[model samples]
Target chain A: MAASNEFRTCSVTGLKVHLPAEALIKANAVVAVVFLAVGGLFGLLVALTRWQAVHILPAEWFYLLLTAHGADVLLFWVIFFEVALLYFASAILLNCRLATPWLAWVAFALMLAGAAIANVAVLQGESSVMFTSYVPMKAAPHFYVGLIVFAVGTLTAVGIFFGTLVIAREERTYQGSIPLVTFGALTAAIIAVFTLASGAIILIPTFLWSVGLITTIDPVMYKVIWWGMGHSSQQINVAAHVAVWYAIAAVVLGAKPISEKVSRTAFLMYILFLQLASAHHLLAEPGISSEWKVFNTSYALYLAVLGSMIHGMSVPGAIEAAQRKLGFNAGIFGWLRKAPWGNPAFSGMFISLVLFGFLGGISGVVLGTEQINLMMHNTLYVPGHFHATVVAGTTLAFMAFTYLAVPLVFRREIVLPTLAKWQPYLFGLGVAGISLFMMGAGTLGVARRHWDITFSDAPLTFEYPPAAILMMGLNGMSAVLAAIGGLAYVLVVVGSILFGKRLDAPDAERPRFIPRLPTTVAAYGSAGTLHVPGTIVLVTVFFMSFVLYYFVNWKYLSEIWPMR
Target chain B: MAITSPEKRVWWNEPLHRPEVIWITIAFLWGLLMFGMMVYWHVAGRQNLSNEAYKVFPEKFAEKVEDMVAKYKVREEGATKIPVVRPPPGSDVYVLSRLWEWWPILELEKGATYRLHLSSMDWQHGFSLQPVNINIQVHPGYDLVLSITPDKAGEYTIVCNEFCGIGHHQMIGKIHVVDKK
Candidate 1:
């Protein structure tokens, strides 16, 4: 009963793209980019301020801009892209119309308005209470209201995602439990409900207090509730980006997961257990018991770790299995050697998975431990750890997906193809350097939020070892390098989308990519029973790195407590 | 309902392949090992694993800190003449936290237990002692008491790890662990 114009076949993937869903996706993506540009600018400023040599911003402006940078990047840009991805996964991938298209637009408008209001409030210089915004120290009422409005908008959008899935089911889009990518998006959407609800639970009361409706807002109560929103927002990113990883593998390599059930179970584990990571923030906080910390931080937390490890092994395993099937079975790493290194989509996803595992994953486990958190919590090491996860893992993966999404969705031939090819390495290398140097400085006891480590103007004085200063200087240099790489990405991606040549040719001349890159998902050459010694060796390296790093941190901890 | 992709069907409901089984098993064992280590460390006192922290009234903490400071004032200029409280070995001690500074520098005897109490007067702050590297979040309404027996005698710097205010970066405290001879 659907109208003819409502859907059209995509020449590249051969899947029908629903017009409503595609429009919504494009809208969200365009907005996401604007936020990214603003956020990136703020990020550069914050980085320069953090650089001891630069020390660009004065104290008040330093904190105000820091708040803006965090909100724009972490909340605005990431969530907008995710909502777009949700619609893509549900409607277009399922070859069904988007449910409640009008409602979806309303939600987008609310989110945009909310973001504008929040940004303006921050710039107006009333709400410099950082992203954590631990209370007793209150912001203007409008700031909390803006956040609540944004959260409600996001909640409505997530509802539309579920509605789209229901339409996909009724329209008979596909059979047998949807695609693995859709399943993973579903996981993200499920977690988004928990994340948004946590925001409402805490922020509404905070808003009321700000407006003089309430007498007192307890600090401990606020933090315990607030982190459910804060930390789990990243959890949503993890699930979404992991889905993007699987989708990239499928699109670029024509790779099927090694075992769909195992991969599905891993996503399920994320839904059930990943939210517990919020406790890591509260682990050292007063009014929380050690028993609660031990329960959340240790044995129970391992199930979630196991979930990620399963994914780390399986994603590469899927790639290796597909590669070996292509007759690249010469040596342990022949498959990896033979991968499409020229494609940014493939290269970025691969780097994201590797660093996300080695640096982010291992350091996360170490930082989450109750005993070890004593040394690393609230240090520069914490940000170093998350930069690996959010920046290296999630943002890089999103950029990889965007490269493919542009050519496929925007119907434009990618301009500056050569720059696109090398952008991942440039950005990934710079980000990796930032992570290492910051963590090194943190390990030597640099403060997490301090504008000046030297404490030049403070009443009391203390000096960090010369090495820690050197590490921070290296971190500053890395930030500049990473900023350049970020510019390359913005230029190449935005340039390609806006200024690239339009492709409107008929079927015969419609090459997959105009510049003659291998754009198709390399076919499943032959189905063989998974033989992946390459991935096995890589996983082993990951394991060895993890164990060595964990022990090294413990050794460092012991040395700090000489009184013991 | 026809599933569009046959390859998806080929692997979706199929049994776990050999490699996945092996990986999952090793992963399970490794997680178990980490879990066991944490438990063993807790039992053996080989970790920074604290278990004795509890809540106390802010007024009580305020009174104790005031008494200790009055008893041990290192008087020079009255403005900066904040006392460095030296409680005897294995006694109860208090450290009060407020805006811009952690109050009343504490001196403890080496190799003896002192139950150190912490609370904030205004907002949430962090108790981050350097060189020793222990961090605890201090809040206005609750007390966090940590039992410590200093095995090394040295001056340790205490930095507030939480972003309490503009002076958050300036919030500093001190712990002087003297020889017990």
Candidate 2:
């Protein structure tokens, strides 16, 4: 048991932070960043090789590094960061001690060891089976074993999060439905459980097959079960990042949700229907019935997508309502214009929200459509779509939240304030380019994971449109820019923790971590009829764009060769 | 605030604003429209993916491809030694995807329809037809059958988009659609 004195009152938020949970958050976050750096470098190499004009790596290295890049970034960096967020939402926000501090440390150690083992297997150069690791193409046994260990570790961390929630409730830490942020984290944790179980069911047999205990894993079955884990993991990201969006709004602007019932109901939709989206990956695969595909891919009438659309409106609506209450009510966009653009936390979160809805959300729905998937399955467009969602959306949101966490949780001031101000825009712009250009190239029918898009040296020949090559070149340039932005973020974050001014001592003269807002605000319904005409206008624009893009894809499908 | 517990104990009973009600209704209507389009396309659209698939052993699938090649081989494609098989209109055409190559080049009439049978001999592969932009997943032990009609006359390339192995990029096939006499 931790000592009662282990709690520290945050000078900024006035919340009691459990010291053990804080340390665990710090450790997990640091490891997550390290993997991000490693994975980002591998991704740069992949982009350069695909550029064709500057094809740097040989064929073998290209496939191997692509595999490494997917695993490290998609699995290691993202999951580790999510674990840290679980602690921050539960133990830290609820103002209670973490359940089983020793067990939390064990989880951390297991994750580190597992990541190291998996990376070693990949680097050893035989197990270049991409992230999907589709069957009949065998990889080293350690690859599966490493991933299983990693999943176990993540599962344990999720268990701790649930246990801590119980602790908070039993200790009567606070009142009234455990805060909206904690509820959102609870949504992520539930999805994580389903995802890990799916991973175990498929991977264990694959592992046994690798070691000669089992034989002949069916390719169709592997794909069906594997996507249950793969796609659900991204859903976990959606829930977590949406929570971050709400958290940033609250911390930066002291914004309360317009209606708790509405927002929470949207999250409930995700829990019920989001996992059915695993069918999105299997839409074009053989041996799957159209009835099954239509039912699962549409999520029993696109209810999960409806959930996202709700968040898309409410997140900004909350911000607009808060800004208006602060007397920024000149026009429709006055709330937006008067927003704190200079603050990295606010800027990053806002950028994440917009890019996610426009690029990721739109492209994902198009690709998931059963008939339209024929034009996109296994194309570079698939990666382009996901990069927008995971990188521009979830990752940027996480990075934004870090700026606030450094000061509040880590007890350190930001080291390079000027660089922090510009990092999100630079990163956001570069990633947007990557996603757009890759999708452009893919629209011209360029294959993904191909070492040579030109089909140079093949017995047969095929020529892509000149525009496709141009898109790859532009994508390579964007990757270089994103790499610089990524480097700026790492330096600022790592340098701050090590050398930035500490805020440990109870000095009244200390600088504020977040901008000061009025302490006493009007209660939810009492705040004189919340008017958010600005948010409504923005959502309308979004709706129009979505309608246009959706029809354009159907037009593209019509131009393809007649098939059934 | 989202970071703190709601001041009201029974927050679920709170009334939604006018804008939210309007937006949710619009979004749900849009969702229903998108769903309807997918179902509508199957009935009326020319371009649609086939859900007709059958499970078979790799050996049996290979034998079928060989038999088709033996029956329909016209000539060896220049320098490559792969047979360009011209199956008759409305007939079953088999193309095999192996380790690093898609075997047996195919030639079809521009206005003729044929049943195309695709399956892999080893790992899973993606059958990506360029220019026309039709793509489908091909897996071993599963024969994916598609009824394809070539509406335009030209040469098209089948690029293996899935990552089969180190030689995945090298796996390319061809289809030559001749004009109807």
Candidate 3:
């Protein structure tokens, strides 16, 4: 792949690309899709199992599948995609060569090996201690070892991303600060460093304990430290997906951030306080002080929320401003109405932005509250919030980007154009149902990790409310819908890569399968008159939902414990 | 200068617009309010128990469980309910968690406060009380004291929400709150 440090600029987009870096980008992206498919399959089964009516897997298999599903989807699939994005942002956008091709390959190999080892451990039955793997309930030593190895690889990739940035700066790739999208990637990379380090700090000793090298490990201490990896890992996703949102807006709509400095400051806020969101996991756990929980849960007053709200507003606001510039400004939502609804990239991202903000972002703050967390933690509500963020938010956004990559990276036309257009809505709707129904069941007191909520086989049986059962059934139907949606995505992407017509370069008579957008947004005009009242209205809706949901949780908490 | 190019005009270096400034102010105010609420809840609401935890030995915990079990064996109906340890009003009560059961059903009086000490004998457990819908994580070798006053008197089931073992779902405890007789 590395004949030389040759360069080729994309004629359509006009960005100079280092040829060696392109190979890495393609490799990482392809691998990410593969993991997403596998992880998604596991997710479907776990959902079916949780359905209770289906009860697909028995207790042991259920736990085993849950572990694999969490690890693969949450960690492996997302990180793989993120690493590809990191390369795209730094090397491609900045028009610089990836710092070390050999090291990047090594990182990829480590990640592949680590993912394989961890999966093997879980399948072997000894490591069925779901993804959290709380200490004292030891998994096989290889489980921790595998995770450590994977983290090290991801950490190496992040380091390489930083190195690429340094090279871009040194070579004067562009004039001023890097693009806002690239800046967002930098935020993700920085957080990755912290997340991986925390994994190593906690997991290494746990690995030792598993192997009998250490006598004992405290479960509470393990939890407190583990979320530094677990929850912070999700934070990494938040940053990366938010970056993807910005990139999609630019690429699909020629939208610029309403104010680059404001957006960058938001990214800066992410670096400062986003990881503190991990404290939400420990809100109800013993061994942590109330002062610690309160301070961290509030995160110095939800500054992290401020960061997200900024991104939320800027992403759509810029799109609105740009659309108005193009004369789509017929009414408050004319720009929105006239948007490229057929382009899976725009539609998927827009849906992701809305669902993520209203469903995930709002519920997150509700769960982050010290008192209210008591009602939500360890319930299906926790997963409900995350599915919105990770699946509805990140995974959907990544799928949208995949549409862009199939053309640019793989040099193939997207297959089933009509199906491609509708894929996001179908899949997004399924995921949304899953999130909402699970949260409803959780609110009705459904256990997060229970094999069976019914407890049918136990000597003493307990039946949940009829509402809870009904909710799980609804969640099950949603899971099936989401699975079908996921299947459509995989078919379209893979079918496109394999059977679709190939594209010809620059000025030929034109190949059969040319991309809809010859080039992404490269030279769109500046952010025009900031008369985005439409965006203001949408954000207002978001704020109202957040306040209402938060207040409802407090009211529920009040009812639970009452007063002294 | 009629700037036609996007790259030529860097949005960051440019002056902030009215919309951006306005949204920033709103967001900052909201964030400040959330943090303020958190502090107020912690200080004033006396909500979210966290200052009441410390490490405890497993052996001493087991001995205490045995004592509580032998102290209050109450037989009712044909089926045998686990011993119900009736602690005095406003006093601390200890409940031991092991294998797949939370033992010594603690009966407390309504309208009076009681500190409930929870710890697991094996692995880790979750103190999930149904109906009330409150969850607190319980770890072995750690005493998590939940300071509570049950306003609604009845029999509440304490289910272990944390995934402990094969029978984690079956691990249930009963907390009966009666009137001050």
Candidate 4:
């Protein structure tokens, strides 16, 4: 199974490297992409069904597609890509051998098994808990079991990745500090481990209960505990996005942050503080003390967001410094004018970060607040907010990273380079459109997880005004854009796998061109390695402001420090 | 320890004072804008709701209910509480019905713009208006308030949106919108 002569072994943490870890990551990413498309398809279908009140599929089939969409895109596709990223960050970037090749494969196998089981269960019409799996509404026992086993498998994968990271650090894998990309991924894995642990608590019990092992059930308690599992999973996804940002910054733009210590510290903060951010979801739920939600949101989530914001500034800071070094002196904005926007890698990095930081980031903060919770809770705005972050921010970042991973990891040349360039625009526009529609519909009080509004007795009518119908139509159009963009991704990836030029030459023979921004100024230093003390202090002061706000606003605690 | 030294720094490092401030300010401004928008939406939503109770249904249905209630009122020895007058097609009415729990309940009507104040004494209940698909969350301590006007006339089915244990799905209510003669 080990193809010895084909790939080069890393000197950092010596283990015989047969398959390029990049290829494994790419192959897995392809799988994730396929699942993402399926999820997107189901999302569009659900939207259509809700809008028109047409039963496209029977209840069983509808639920199956819904379940599959949640598992595949939200769960399977996202986690698989994160795993691929873990391997890249730990092994490939650090020039280290994996801790155990067999363990890596085992992780992959278990993930596949879990995905297959979940998919089959959904197809057979057994499990449909609407992704969150709130208690009392039980799915088949196998469904819960499958989810548990799947989570365990993914956690094991996290363990293996962590093992590689630790060994590389101890063994002096690289000459200097760990690369920023790897650091981001390291944080993501740390967050994932904790998040998955929450899943273990709820799924196991839910599984046991489903099999009639536990007769009595309290829905309220179950809801409280389940969110510990449920909400943290989203935190892991956000962490993955942070990692992708650094990866794109390095791999695509060949730009390194100005300060390694500052960047890594920000990532470390994300690792430590990300879990508490789950309180944002529990803001409006009854039984949870308002004080708890308030503390969680402001203290934990706000800190994590602060970490994200630090990185947000750092990403562009690195790019700007890098551009300066390259002698692009038009102005601060001149570097942007001069930078290589045409390159798929550069564009992806820039667009994903911009969207994640602004649109997604703002919505996240508002949702984290107490007063805003009354309006946005469980409404269409719920999906509106997530699609901005998960789909637009994290997923888009992964897609951009794929442009690099496909070639390096998969050993396949990109088929249509130009079309690849067009994807971010289309996907971004689609997400924006969908989010607006959902936000507007939320204003009109639309709920999620219902087959149709007609199913409810709210006396809602089909005769929507021009603005509402326009919003719905806009959402549909955005779905169309998303489909096209997703198709473009598949075509480039799959086409390269089947027909593109395969590099049979040695590692040295491959072209090594990490594209740089067009305009380069030589101001402070290489953005990759500058010491920016002032920025760090500023961020600290900014974070402390939130802490100060929390102290004064105890009633405001539910928004941040949620207990439920 | 050696790698951590400042001497090992790469080329692109610079202070982010300018960008950081600019971005944070932009975010703050956007936050204000959203808050403004949210306030507008809340007020607009409230304005759209009606505070009036049961408006007499269309011309046809109002006449039938009036006739039926009047006949019952005259036959009874003392049914003084019964309302028998032919209300204008636009007039409002309020009444009570026992839901799945056999508790006294009051519901709002469609098209009859009325402020329906609903509450359950015994258990948690869901007061959902059919055809409109608006669900007013109901609980023991707090009174649920909804100002609604049903645009369409029909038999609207109301089911509980909340999980209130067994027979939850069977919890149903009706709103009769009488047509004007």
Best by DockQ: 2
User: Chain A only: TM-score of every candidate?
Assistant: 0.96, 0.98, 0.96, 0.86
TM-score of only chain B in every candidate structure: 0.86, 0.97, 0.87, 0.53
DockQ-wise, the better of 3 and 4 is 3
Ranking by DockQ: 2, 3, 1, 4
Give one digit per residue, the lDDT tens place, for model 3 in A47-89.
8998888999888888888899999989999999999999988
lDDT of 2 by residue, A1-564 (tens): 458899988887788999999999999999999999999999999999999899999999999999999999999999999999999999999998999989999999988888988999999997999999999999899999899999999999999999999999999998878888888999999999999999999999999999999978998899888998999999999999999999999999988888888888888888899899889989888888888998899988899999999999999999998888787888899999999999999999999999999999999999899999999988999999999999999999999999998888888888898999999998999899899998898888999999998988888878899999999999999998888888889998999999988877787334333788776445544333668888989899999999999999999899888999
Q: Per-candidate TM vs. native? A: 0.95, 0.99, 0.95, 0.74
Residue A357, candidate 1: C-alpha displacement in angstroms: 0.4
lDDT of 4 by residue, B84-174 (tens): 2223333333222223431212232334554344444333444444334344334333333344454555555444444343334344554
Candidate No. with top lDDT: 2
* Global local distance difference test of model 3: 0.82
A170 in model 1: Cα distance from truth in Å? Answer: 0.8
Better TM-score candidate (1, 2): 2
Which of the two, 2 or 3, has more lDDT?
2
TM-score of 4: 0.74
Per-residue lDDT over B1-181 for candidate 1, one digit per residue giving the tens place of the 0 to 100 score: 0112334445555667777788888887888877666666566645454545556667877998888777765532214555687777777788888888878888888778877788898888878888677777788887777777777889888888878878888878788888876
Candidate no. 1 TM-score: 0.95
Model 2: per-residue Cα lDDT at residue A90: 98
Error of 3 at A259 (Å): 0.3
Off by over 4 Å in 3: A1-5, A507-529, A562-564, B1-13, B76-81
lDDT of 3 by residue, B103-174 (tens): 767788887888878888888888888878878888899888777888878878777888887788777777
State the weakest 10-residue window (summed lDDT) of model 1 chain A.
A511-520
Angstrom error of the Cα, residue A506, model 4: value is 5.4
